[model samples]
Target: MFGWLFGRRKQEKFFLEMMKAAAEGEGRRKLFEAASMLGIIIKGAGTDEEKCAQIASGLVNNLLKASGTNINSNEDDQFVAALFSVIACSHFSRILTSQFELSAMLSWVILTAGDIEKIEISNQATEYYIDMTERKAPVLIAAGNSIAKWVNQPTAENFRAVVNVFDHCRSMVGYA
Candidate 1:
């Protein structure tokens, strides 16, 4: 069962590579197809954190380059935004910390506020970190500090959430 679950991830990675090649060759049609495949992978297999992290890392690297052609274009931005949104809200948030590149990509997602409010995705991301920390302190503390920098500015709602996160972290000090 687990093998079947992870198989889709492998397929997704292969498609992402193909997409990267297509985009590099400036094959717009293939790029679009690759992007669509990525979107499907994100939607379907995103529950696997490592797979989602891998996809996010690839998309961020490729999309940035692709965007250079018309980085500011609404359509291009929407595609990248959608990809980021899926990973940000997926069940694999903790898997993000395992890969430094993916973690950096996640930081970008937070910095850019990519579709965050649209799905309240950023909040979910913070929650994932908090939960991870409850299981292990040091690993998550570093991630928390990095993530905290992104959400440091506290509006009333954000402030409340941050406070709750800190409280959760405090509770798990030696227990974890």
Candidate 2:
């Protein structure tokens, strides 16, 4: 039992560090590793709804906080997109859609998807949006509303990101 407890602590440490690395623009391997850990925790959370929710919330919070940073590199954009994809693909995704915080974070992701200067970042966000749509995640409507709001914004920032988001949102309308 002590061994199990100790191993859990180690896993937690590893997971936290990887998440930090992913958010801080540390490295790609760490980003993927952290994303993989999230995937494992979520997939293994069968029948453990609280555990799944906690992990999902933590990841979303982290990503939202990290999004405050000005993306400095293509890898940074990829890392953000990767983290978003992991959360978007999770079994808890549908439930997360109903959550105000998670939905807001997702909306922010869609708003920022207009960062088209970074092609990979735009692509990744678009793909993540598509995946969420395919899952029929309930957040699509909230995202659509958010997209409409962003569309009216006067700033040119993330303009392409908005266009991409518009395309994905349009595709998801009939299905989601």
- TM per prediction: 0.21, 0.24
Compared with the true structure, the alpha-carbon lDDT of candidate 1 equals 0.41
**Best-performing candidate as measured by TM-score:** 2
Deviation from truth (RMSD, Å), model 2: 16.8
- Candidate 2 has what TM-score? 0.24
The lDDT for every candidate, in the order shown, is 0.41, 0.42
Residue 145 miss distance in model 2 (angstroms): 1.2
Residue 68's lDDT within candidate 2 is: 42
Q: Candidate 2's residue-wise lDDT over 1-176, tens digit each?
A: 56666798788898899987665443323322443443424334333333334443344433333344333433544444333433433433333223433443443344345355544554565566667668877555444433233323323343334334433443443321
**Model 1 segments beyond 4 Å from truth?**
1-61, 66-71, 88-176
Error of 1 at 135 (Å): 32
